[model samples]
Each structure stands twice: as structure tokens, then as C-alpha cells.
Target: MPAARTRRARAARKRQRRMAGVEHDLSADEWAGLQEAWGGCAYCGASGAALQKDCVLPISRGGRYTVLNVVPACASCNASKCNDEVTGWLRRKRLDERAFLTRLAEVHAGL
Candidate 1:
């Protein structure tokens, strides 16, 4: 048997979690934002991948629970990001952060 550390625990847990559907914890707008993502990862576009809830502006950095701050990210992206701010992480990954930039601008502008 494989050691516990070598086993795919997150995947196993994900399978178990699917039956319950992870959206129960989200607000109506958050669910809308998640559904708008079309089940693929919002960042890397990995289809049907196991996803995690991510805050575009991290709570630790003084972000809020507003729907605009939430996005569905694949487990790999989410774990790699940890508490880092969203736009900076995207920049470090060499991806265009324009959409987020516009959104952040709109948010700060009270849109």
C-alpha cells in the first residue's frame, strides 16, 4: 500500500465532496459568479478539474467576502496562490492581468 503522503487524498476527498455539491456555502451572487465560470478553471481553463474557492483580494490582505472578490480556481492554482493577492500572482505567472485590473478599478470606483 502507498504511504498516506503519497496517496491522492485531495482527489479522494474531492470525489466524496462532489455528492454534496460545494455551492451550498456560497451566497446567491457568489453562486452566479461561480456558474459564470462554466465549470472550467477561471485562471488556467482546466476543464472538469477539481476546484477551490479563491478570493481575488485575499482576506488576510483586507479583502472582503463580496461576490466580486470570489472566483473559482482549480485546486492547483488555488494552493499555489495561498493568500497572495490575485493580480500580483497572475503577473508573476506571466499572464495578462488586464481583466482583473479593470475590475479592481471599477470596484475602487464604486461600481
Candidate 2:
């Protein structure tokens, strides 16, 4: 049988594919970075006690369900960031855009 963590990671990937577009198919390894960010919101460093997968770029703006775009989030961060430009939203929240971008770049690079 597959391990529980493996199963969750797979589920996350499936969700990503669904988010990208119904016709778009994807695999788990695409966002393996999510496993590393499992415990907290990649945005505010908030505990992802209830983790949310947020797209860095809005799907409306053509964000794909790819590792480079998705990041772990807490419920609040995800809700507040909904559909806004990431940098603009982060600035409105008084969050550090540079740091978040740096972290995201690292995650993308690792992939």
C-alpha cells in the first residue's frame, strides 16, 4: 500500500490539476515542494494547521496548476489573497513581498 503522506501529496497534485483546468492533467512530483511547506502558510509563515493551496497568480490571469505557482497557505491568508495580484495584496496586508517572492523563487528553483 502507498504511505499516507504519499497519498496526501497525490491528492494535492490532483487538486492542482483540477484548479488548472478540467482538461489539464498533472502529476504529483510537479509540486513536491508542497510536502516541505506542509506545516505553515508559505505566505505569512502562519501555521497551516488548516493548510490551503493558493495559486500565486490567479487562474483568471492564466496561472497554471504548477509547482511554481502554488504554495501552502492558512485559511485566512488564502481568503484574503483571493484573486488579487500577489504583490499588491501582500503590500496591502503589510507583508514582505520581497521575502515571499524570494521564498517562492526558491521553491520554484528547487523544482
Candidate 3:
């Protein structure tokens, strides 16, 4: 049983690594879209000088280069949100997501 468990663990690790390919750095347009989507930081609602670009899908999770998966977030919020998906992260922050998604669609549609 112990050996079987070890094999299963190894297999799980292998599967994760295989699925976790690298993601490219966000592009100019993608960054623009993200800034527009967040209208500032998605977490704390900060805008101006310290605003930063964040990856919606983490590179460690094989996030592809897509505009739909990035957003602007302040440094503090970015650190807090980290690699979590937008919906999950925002829900944890108790943010209203309806408007965000609507804007996201508009931004992506134009791209």
C-alpha cells in the first residue's frame, strides 16, 4: 500500500509539471486591457503611480499569453492575489464581479 501511494504521488507530480508550461510576459495591449479592466487595482482599487500589471493566470499553472487573463493591480493587492484566478480572488475580497466581466468582454472583443 505504501508503494502504491508513492507511485500515485509521483504520477500526480508528473501530471502537474506537464501541465505547467511557461507563459509569456504580458504584451502592451494585454497590459492596456488589464488596466482598463481593473480600472485600478482589482483588489484595493488603487490607481496612479504605483499601479502594476498582474497575471490573471499564473505562469506556474501554464497560463497562456491572453488579454482575457491579465489585470492591473496595486503592489499590495497583487501580492495578496498572487496566482489565484480573478473570480476566486475577487470573491475572497468580496468584490462585485459583474461589472468587471462586462468590461473584460468589451476589452477582449475589441482586441
**Residue-by-residue lDDT tens digits, candidate 1, 21-100:** 43334487655556454456666667777766777766556555555666667888888787887777888977668865
Cα error, candidate 2, residue 2 (Å): 45
**Residue runs of model 2 more than 4 Å from their true location after superposition:** 1-26, 29-32, 37-39
Q: What lDDT does each candidate get? A: 0.64, 0.75, 0.70
Model 1: per-residue Cα lDDT at residue 21: 48
lDDT of 3 by residue, 1-111 (tens): 999999999978975675555545567876776676567776566778477766667655666556666666788878887778877877887877776667667767776
Of the candidates numbered 1 and 3, which has the greater lDDT value? Answer: 3
Give lDDT for model 3. Answer: 0.70
The number of clashing residue pairs in model 1 is 0
lDDT per residue, candidate 2, 1-111, as tens digits? 569989999978966775657333335765444757444788789762777667888775777656667788888998899789999999999999999888777766766
**lDDT at position 85, candidate 1:** 74
Models, CA RMSD each: 7.0, 9.7, 6.9
TM-score of each predicted structure versus truth:
0.58, 0.70, 0.62
Select the stronger candidate by TM-score from 2 and 3. Answer: 2
Which pairs clash inside model 1? none
What is the TM-score (0 to 1) of candidate 1? Answer: 0.58
